[model samples]
Target chain A: MLDIRQTVEKPRMREKISEFRVGDTVKVSLKIKEIIKEERNKKKGSKEKVTEKEKIYPFQGIVIKRKGGGIRETFTVRKESHGIGVERIFPLHSPIISEIHVLKKGNVKRAKLYYLRDGKKR
Target chain B: MIGLIGKKVGMTQIFSEEGKVIPVTVIKAGPCKVVQKKTKAKDGYDAIQLGFGEVKESRASKPCIGHFKKIGLKPMEILEEIRIEDLSKFKECDEIKVDIFSNSKFVNVQGITKGKGFMGVMKRWGFKGMPASHGTHRKHRHPGSIGQHTDPGRVFKGKKMGGKTGNEKITVKKLSVAGIDLEKNILLVKGSVPGSRGSALFIFSDLNVPVNLQTTQLQAENKPVSVEK
Candidate 1:
């Protein structure tokens, strides 16, 4: 019975997910799609047509919290941008995530590093 | 409506061709056998009774075992009747699988929801309880004011109040079919269905609704092509 549940989620599970825990600094490569509008001057009036383009954006941050299990697992990445703390949660098995590269492993006792959110840089 | 008996496996998320995540509920449907077919002349109604989930003969009653024996099929744990306009396609003891839903776009899933025993009006009917603080004393979750003073002096009928909640038959309509696995008899439905995990569900394809063939076409075309080795 458990095997059937696993089989249901097997297709969505990514094969090459990097192993990382809370307090580990990692770089997440996400595929982002942006619509670019170009003006075409065919007649008297100019018409703007939009086209979609895909691009990869890498977000390097420290792992603050990891929640849920199996294919629904999500991790929160916290990073300081422009002297302000920025946090983003990403689904582990999401196809939008192109790659996850573990940069540095931090020594932490607790499972969730939420203290780092408001506390000093550890 | 053509339908089948199924068990709710669980919920999972799948990625679309556009890389958008879609939450889906997996249901292990059919491989159901036609236990009995009711005709208009005989039973005054047109319906096909399908039996699903194999059970031991010892576990089932003598009459149930005898019924399966009459059909020459194994004892089934659940039996459900599906009313169909055309009954010529099915016969007695004919095996029906998840493939029946292959062409179906949307399905209505019926099941008994999980029981939340003796719930309050706040939880059951989403009633706004008493205000907290500002001289409000210990009546935060109370259902304020049932009746007026002495005019009628009785609570009106069909009033939404605190009572037993859930453990009742509920139908979720127009749930799109995400995917179908014929080999394993698994039907992945987009969005949530009622009932807890491992609960029996009646999944029926709406007869009057038009099929969403465009999504199915996109799903088929988006399959990753394998490289020839």
Candidate 2:
């Protein structure tokens, strides 16, 4: 049943998806859109000027878990800032992800490094 | 409105023009053939009959096979008649493709919701069951009360109660069409439709008044409308 579904989704799936797995330290660049509205008092008929800007922000962390399959695939990353652990799940084939750079691959036995959720897990 | 018979091919996500992710359900839509055309002067109504999918000769009745053979067409597995106001351009054996909706921004999909047989009031009707701790025994999932004992005693005819859930025709209106594949006859409708994967659905163009399912019920009450693929 999923075979026909795969055919429709295969083309949309990223061809250059980064080859990385759980416990791998990676930096993910995300695309964010910002809308700025400017008002000008030139004329009564003039409308407000609206501008859209695309920004790329980077989130560097260790891959804690990866789940789902096909275009719906997603992975969770854990990073600590100010002694507080932060985790974000990214859809593996999401267009919002501008780039993914694998920094270091850790030799972890488990597929999901959820133990890191406890904070500073050895 | 004109529509095509389509089979649910499951769902997936695709990037929009602005690089935003959009969830869409892929449907293998027609390539349906106009098997017969009904004229008001002849049949008392103006309509067009369409045939979809193909099957072996042995699977179909001999008379059905002859009917298709008479028109120089292969025996189709499913046949549907749609009441149309404009039938001047269409003719018998004319092919209708998914491209009929190339300019359609949205479509209406109708299908049977996944059936969950005979369920309790709590699951089916969202009725708040009895409290667990307040001296309640075995009526935890029971519906609180029926009505007055003698005055208008019997339960209302259309009262919400525990019974069959789903497995009935439902139309989801105004689902945006995310994409269309003319070559593959695939329609990417933004959002989910009723029924499971491989289930048959009627995709009606937004311009049409969604007469497919309702007309089927009004015309043929005993027969199953769309064939399950």
Candidate 3:
């Protein structure tokens, strides 16, 4: 039988993920491939009133919980945009994650910050 | 027709190039040596006998030593014969590594399942036992009935009553070969194989790979796919 440690080392994942715990605010950079938009829409002859603008959506959130082990381990990040809680879970060893930046350390005393969903707790 | 002697090495998770976690059973497969070949004319079938694992000379008895000496090979702890279509392709003492399974997409793992002694119908056969509430007495886990009253006048032949369970040879068919570690002689199967760690398993390369799945030569195409545990 193989030792658990040995099997986990197969095709080793990146060992240096930014270490942040539950309740810590962090920013995660994710690479996304989006299609290009037409730039010629503003040709004065165009009577269409373009009231909405395209804004870049990348890099956000606060680490709420880190669960599981080995390469499957993941952490949940929560961010509030316009008062709505938005949470994202990212695998610690995922190659798709470009970078993890620990913005601030939280002093809360809990393993999982699920209580944050209640919105009133510190 | 291809086979190998592998030790059940337990299980672990591995990440593929695409960064997905796959649960896999790791087995210490051979570095096996072909000991003998059975041909149609001589044995009514063609087969290859493979020897795996090693034991100290003193631990091997005279008869066992004689068997190895007769074939001019070292003593092996496990010896198993696998039916093959051709016997002329191999010679005695030809080293077979984890690589034999490397070319194979799926394998049939034969091992004695873990024994669960004298179990009841509920645990053995998935019988939903009677309720444990106020109305129930000692018949909670008891099997409801064995047979009808007077129809056949005899108990049915293949009734699903519980008796001794497990510790019997089981064949887990169509298990994909997830990975092969030639240096460690280990094989990572995509799913759980019967038996526990340190148990002996006879891993035979499937001869009957469906025509569609065989087009890829059984090698993994996508990275880090989830395997059933």
Candidate 4:
């Protein structure tokens, strides 16, 4: 039988996320909207209207986990910034993601690198 | 009020126009026919009964076949009556499509939740069990102290204990309507509804109903667009 759910979802899922797995280093580019309130003077005088602008925000990290299936899929990316570990989960088919760049492929035995959160082995 | 008989398809996350992720539950709603109408003068109330799904004539009972024949409509699998404030807007045998909610922003969904067979207190009532340490001794996940000492003597009535869970009618009100596919009769609701996949659902539109002012204020602050209490 034809599934109406699949038909409705097919058109929205236009992004084909790159094949990257746990321990692989990648970069994700997201289109973010920011509101810019312009000031007319050096003081708190604002004559100009607030403007909404879109910009590409990039994050480079190692893929730690990939969860879910199909267009509803999400993956976790972890990176070290100034000796602090930062993790972010991105939806695979989200329209906000502009590009996914795979930098290096990694060979690991586990699908999820959650053990890396405990302590730095390297 | 405008409503339809529908079935839950499944749940999925979709992207909003603002580049935000929204979890939605897809529903396949009615193109049902108004099988009968009960007028105020004759029946002492105004109600329109709708028929959903198709069934073979041989599979239906004699009375059901006659009921469909009276309205000149084909046999439908389920018949449900919806009480309404006005009956003049609709006629018997009139088809109610999924587009009835095109102008409506929200809807109330009602369905029978999936049944969990004979669950324990931990899973059913969300009761905190005894401590794992300190000589608890095989008393994990047990509901302690049903009643007080000899003063009360008996367990109080309607205590929060485990019993049959789910499989009961639940209504989730003021769920935002994300999108509607009129051609396929599919409705995309912005949040979760009752029941598992493939369960029967009643979708009541918020066309004439007044919007809750409190929720409209919350929506202005960019909170979740729901008023389900």
Model 1 chain A weakest 10-residue run by lDDT: A113-122
TM-score of 2: 0.87
Q: How large is the interface RMSD of candidate 3?
A: 2.9
User: DockQ for each of the predicted structures, in order?
Assistant: 0.45, 0.67, 0.30, 0.35
- Model 2 segments more than 4 A misplaced: A38-49, B133-135, B208-229
Candidate 4 lDDT over B1-229, as tens digits, reads 6689988999887888776888999998998899999887999767899888889999989999999999788789877788776678889889998888888888999999888988989888898998999999998989998988998788889998888888999999999999999998999999999998888889996565434645645755989876576
Per-residue lDDT value at B23 in model 1: 88
Model 1 DockQ class? acceptable
True contacts kept of each: 0.57, 0.83, 0.47, 0.37
After superposition, candidate 3 runs with Cα above 4 Å error: A3-10, A31-59, B16-18, B207-229
Give per-residue CA lDDT, model 2, range A1-122, as digits (tens). Answer: 57767777888888997799899999999999989998877687667999999999899999999999888888999999888899998888887888999999889999988788776546
TM-score of chain B of 3: 0.85
Reference-based lDDT, each prediction: 0.87, 0.86, 0.78, 0.86
List the candidates ranked by DockQ, beginning with the highest: 2, 1, 4, 3
Error of 1 at B151 (Å): 5.2
lDDT measured at residue A92 in model 1 versus the true structure, 0 to 100:
89
Give the CAPRI rating of model 2. medium
Residue B170 CA displacement from its true place in model 3, Å: 1.7
The estimated TM-scores of all candidates read 0.85, 0.87, 0.79, 0.81
Q: How are the candidates ranked when ordered by TM-score, highest leading?
A: 2, 1, 4, 3
